[model samples]
Target: METSGYTTQIRDGLFDPSPRDSIFRVKAAVADELAALDDTARIRSTDFFNHTFAPDFVLTWPDKAERHVFLRMSYDLNALVEDVALIDSHDPFIFGLTPNEGTEKDSRIDGAVEESGAMFAEPDALERLIDRKKTDSTANMLSNAIAQGGRGTFIGNEAVEFASVVSRGFEAASDVKAAGTAEAISEIEERLGGPQAWRMNRVLQAVWEGSEGPLMLFPGKADLSGRLNIESLRYLVTYMRTDDPEFWKRVGRGLKMADLEHLDFAASRPNIERLIKANLDILSARAMVLVDDPLGVGEIDRESKFSWDIRERRLTFEAPGFFAFIGATKKDLESVRKTTANPVAVSTFVDRAEKAELAEVTLHSGSEVFILKHEDGAIDTHRLVGVSGQFDGPSEVTQAIATSSSGRVTVDLTAMSGTGQTRSKIRLADLLVTATPLLRDLPYEDTEALNHYLAYEVDHGGVTLDVPDDEESLVDDGVAGGAEPDDEDE
Candidate 1:
């Protein structure tokens, strides 16, 4: 009944039996109706006046990631009554127009942001699942550290296996999933049992152990998957383990890499793989930040700027610093009832853990995190660019967090000789984040016109923020790296 959400059966009722003659019949009917009209005002009221007569189909670049986007178009789903009026009265082709349109977000993955954000939900209850600290296991610790560090190397080199990079990124991000830094990288080995954190670390160990390469890999796909951008995740894994033959075996077979000759890698004879190394080296240092607001909303804003050349093969990313403000709300801590195989007297416990844990935490706004802060001329709304973090609060609080007057517009930037840093600056109604000029050791790699800021907030007991600045400009080499990032998730 449908090819792109349209029905062939509906086509027969609107027009004559001969589909080929419909256009001509509609045209003749239109001519007769126009001729019968005495005034222009009547003509303007005709059915044709409100419709788009003709439109153009946009040509696409096949190799670009964003090429053919699909959007569901519901406006034309209804079958209209046959009009005795003007043009296209018998045009069966009118029914053939698809009600769906191709979308334009090329960087998007197979799933939408909301769908991908579901992975961060709680895996199991506390008593049901146990935590396994990983850092105590020297062998895994070494392997994990190597893979994590090699992620940096792979970021400098694009050929690394995609799975390897993503696994490591996920492990690093998941470390912050708990209430505290009880399981820092140094403590992972001891924490490695069967907890969500351990399971993620176990996956990272697999990527490292997957054929003498970086440990990075995860499931192909899952519905409602959070922070689960397939290709982008794959790209990170591939970045660290390019030498592994199996890496190419899994991904290239499915994506038709050889068939895509129009891509820069396919066309260039001089330096096909030049950008590979350049991008890897830069992004390797760039921190992947995790943000949690009250609304099940998280964002990744970076202080690190990336640089890449389309003509020449070059790229870079670095993390000068990182910051985040995470909060919880009553709505996010609701109890969940579950039926399990090992039912123990239908037990009941107050769910201390935030039930809405990290659900919807993802790179929906573009990358792994979104930058929600922007510039406005108000005294409190100062700009704090190059920060990374998400709102770790419950969904209810996300609505409470104030944003700029203009609707939130998230953008990715490219830079040259620019600093690669990640930081998150959370500003509330009374709380303000002032982007102070560079002071102390700044993260900027170059002396570009970079904007910076500091966050002010209140914790369990007292207000938090350094003393207000006395001067506008800085006294040091303009590097302000000393400001401690926001504290542990509560």
Candidate 2:
């Protein structure tokens, strides 16, 4: 399984393959286990056992109510394996795998599709581990695999050695006992808070120049500050294990990859968008930022009310926003840039938007000639399903709103109409909007992305986006100084 001598030189490429075929072979074994789930063809004994308990504690089903209920996950690994194996056969130099110079302005693909020999990923190890959770009880099995990876000889031992180095660092960390383990994780996170810290922590090259195997732990970005996370070490060791007790919990626990110390920041319960994103076979890890946040259109008539529909391929969505369709895939995100690039249609949003300037009402629900005021405020008297509209008492005619593209107000004229006469009145209310910056490409701006820009003051041509005053995170930047803080010496 030694890969040190066969693959690309570590100083050279970030995306390189392992010299050992065993790694993929082991992964292929894992794939077989997951594929077993779909093997309904396999006959099993009628007898079943019951031992289900959830740390989150929710009744998932009638019989299995007390146990932690897992959502199903499935993918065409047959295709994935083909793609992975394909990456091994060719070098970018020979096959044009590296990113072209022109692609610099464009976003990087979540998975490298077209390459110029620059970057290559061999079935990401972390992704392979997470993918196991889709099958029944594979989380526990994968945990066992990861746990064994470290202690056992062969490839597993290599995994162990890496974990050992991380553990040694964690224990030796000065912040260990003083702040408590969890808090220490927080402190280490604070230390690695900036995007650059993460980039620095990455393994510079995927394949090393010479090694018995890929150099497991080259201190390219080891934290000497003695505040690194214990789980960082533990994750390295047990990430591949499904039977590791915490495997399912880790995957099932939280959907969002919050900031380092965000373990303390509680999630505001899961919503529709989150549920789909977490449970889908292919999660769109791509984060999107909002150029202009959309709002809801007031409830109106059938002809005037807004409506939206979801596309077949799309699965992820950001709510109470613009667009008609509701879901998307990774490829769809790609076409946005590849396409004309003007007003890129991301996925199939319902295009159901409410423009304050375009507010209008065609159907009057109840011959109630109430003043339908515009911009003053609006309400949903009948309650829209996929449409948004409004009616005021003192106003006459007003503009219109695009609820689907903008907000989540719904209307079902089919349900609430009388002889071609509209009959509902909804008063308008000021938007109760919560402004959260939309995250998109370049979201994970690790040091690699901002090469040579570490702690460079923004005033002196440092890498800084013109973030809105209200939207930018002081917590993220670690420079809480307000309004206009000097970027010079503290």
Candidate 3:
């Protein structure tokens, strides 16, 4: 039988049927072994020897003060063993005082430093996903602006203007930097597609149409508050129109008097309800960012040095002087994807469109006159249609694209903030790269003192052998440090 991974089952064979008797016997055996050692030898070996008679048996004397030690071992799913010794002492844990009096100091700097460094050293996978989403959204927003020919769309000779008045109020209160300037936004929009640009403008106009004052969507008012409020409107419209009980329950806590009236009106008409949901989905799918307060606030900010505080739901900016912070739960972010049927295909097309940088082009179905840049490696086959129109179509764009490219499509739907946004893992090898600057900044006297202290600690902390009873006689006989080596030649 394959019994290697089962530590408990394997160790059980060593014991009698009764657990109490087994424990007693084990303790007796350990005590018996210790009794054989002399006081001097015991003291010397305590700090020197780590007695591992078996995988389950671990002993550490470390010194006369810390003789009582317990072994802890566990196996992971991969059958890898982790072992450690927890020492108990009558003397306080550190500084040679009673446990209650001594303020135990963790002198092992290496361990604490390594643990603190891991968070910043290794970039989290989730952070990478968020970064990609940010880039995609920025690109999409810029592309949308570019497609509009540096102007808003018109309906029956009336130009559809962006709700600049409402947007200005948000802009002034918050230091939120739009993903791009009007020119860049317009340029990218043109490059991606004109119809998409128009659609985007229309969506923006719809949200800002009736809003005269600050719309408080969330509980707090800080940077990116207004923008996130606008984004949440999409979900609000859907949940209210569809009468989603759970969504309503959650929103009820945050809803205002004006919001209640608006929802009541939206829920009254079926066509308006459908229109709102469709438009919201379109906005969410095109480019949206979901953050878990990457710029930590309150209790989290104090605890994490203002890094991400997912537990408290406080947003934090990765870099200093960052202007905006949007926070949301993963569930809220994923809901956008869940609502869309052909996200991958649309995402892939957007990526390609951004890459090509065309001013305007037709979709696959050859129905909608959209703006898309044509590059050397552009997607030529499998046309898309009705992308500009509501219910234009949902097709297997992902499957079609997959056939052309062997590489997998990666689309990140969320963006986060933190140091991980910029750098990857920092290994031990990076110590020189990181520490040199700090070392240079320190005064020569401090550096010398630091070096001397480290050397002294290293020398004193090292284990040493006890002097032999016949030290002089052994030295005279050419035996040193306890044992003499046998001459292989002889």
Candidate 4:
């Protein structure tokens, strides 16, 4: 007969007929042979076998200081003899002991017994393992969803329902089948949509299903506090309104609110406005813009100049004598020129402006106010009187002024104490350093820095001041009092 491995036979009448005596003699003989292989080995009857009443012996010993290994051998006689041979030689029958070589039956019994022992050792081990596996599978699903652009792919509760199905399918399967089921579930989950995807999908549905687009569902202020992939939302709107793959890619990379300021939303204006209102809290000034004009009226007027305060989210149109302490770039200045009527003035401002972090811009009917914070914490306020239409470039400042306490130095270029004062020509460059000594060390020529600084200031506050034709004052009254006026007219 075929056996797993080596086998040995013993004469049937070698021991007493009594089962207990016979078993003892058989074990004693086996122990002698086992000792030759490992002196420390011990033999025990596991009472597990392939056939009824047949027992299996386990030989276990320490292989290393703290590690143990075992071998199993089964004792059987009927399995070894043919049917005809067994009938003829029933009296002089031979018994055989065959070593078990990790067969399917032996493995299953070992696994069951080991698991039972483990349950006694740690009651929550299996549960913890299963939980960990589930968590890992979920993480993999999310990763795949993100990598495959699975955003907005699912409907409400669909992802959860699919996950439940996968779980149930796994549970109904056998151990071997369960492994295959789990793998298939992982692949399927990767393709299925997730929570964020479902949210996007819902938004898309709302936009397409209603006449007012997303505004029909979220009219006043939509709250999208935790959503990070705003690009997808932008893509949806942009795709519906226009087909610009390059712009879409840029949106995908992530566009600032300022970037979208120039983009024409067309039919998707309501959707874009909804998105903007929903994320106002998280939108920085550099990434956002506030327009005073009506939506879808006409092309943006490139000649109208405006100043933006980042912290206050204020925008001032055609404001004169406003200072932008925030950073700006040539590119940003060019973008501003396109929206303003006075490109020459913007170009001029671009040539002279410097980047600063702690300045405020306010427009007064007859005066311009500038608040300057010095290195020594001293605040100097400078007011420019009767400087109308003098500095009309796109001015953007950082948000530092809005969030800062009153301790901040503010330069209000509003109408000064003297309304009908004689105006003297003063160079804009001289006014900046004279108002704030800190500006002397800063690079005023870097337009890039100015663009960055403008982003912050415009978000805070942008004040518009009307210049009265009567107050043509050009003299630096406050910090620039001692400086002599240049011969050239400003």
Winner by TM-score: 4
Worst 10 residues of 3 by lDDT: 91-100
- Name the TM-score of candidate 2: 0.22
Residue-level lDDT of model 4, residues 338-438, one tens digit each, is 12221122123222222233332332222332222234332222221223234453332111121122112222211111111123222112222222222
lDDT, candidates in the order shown = 0.21, 0.23, 0.25, 0.28
- Give the number of the best model, judged by lDDT: 4
Root-mean-square deviation (CA) per prediction:
28.1, 23.6, 36.0, 25.3
Off by over 4 Å in 4: 1-231, 235-255, 258-264, 286-330, 335-490
**TM-scores for every predicted model:** 0.16, 0.22, 0.15, 0.22
lDDT string for model 1 (1-490, tens) is 1221112212222256665464334333333322221111111122221243321111122222111111111222222111101222111112112223433212221121222111000111110111111211222222322222211111111212222333344344333222122233323332222132343344333333222222223321112222213332332332232333333222221121111222333223112132222111111111111111223211133223321112112111122332222111111112311112111110110011111111111112222333232133211111111121232421111100122211111111110001111122222111111111111122333222222211111222222212112122112101112222112210
Question: Tens digit of lDDT per residue, candidate 3, span 273-328?
Answer: 33322222111111112233234334323322222212223221221112122212
- lDDT, model 3: 0.25
Candidate 2 local lDDT, 1-490, one digit each (tens): 2223112222122232553443333323323332331221122211111111111111121112121111111122243223433433222201111122331322332133233121222222223333444542323323332321111111113222333333333332322222232232332233222332242132111111111112234333344422223333222222222233222222322222111112211221122222222222212121111221145332221122222122233321222333222111112222221111121111111122221122223232235432222343442322221232343322211112212111222221111110100111110110101011101122233212222211121112221211213212222221111211123212
* Model 1 stretches astray by more than 4 angstroms: 1-5, 8-10, 13-15, 18-432, 436-490
lDDT at residue 19 of model 4 (Cα atoms): 72
Worst 10 residues of 2 by lDDT: 418-427
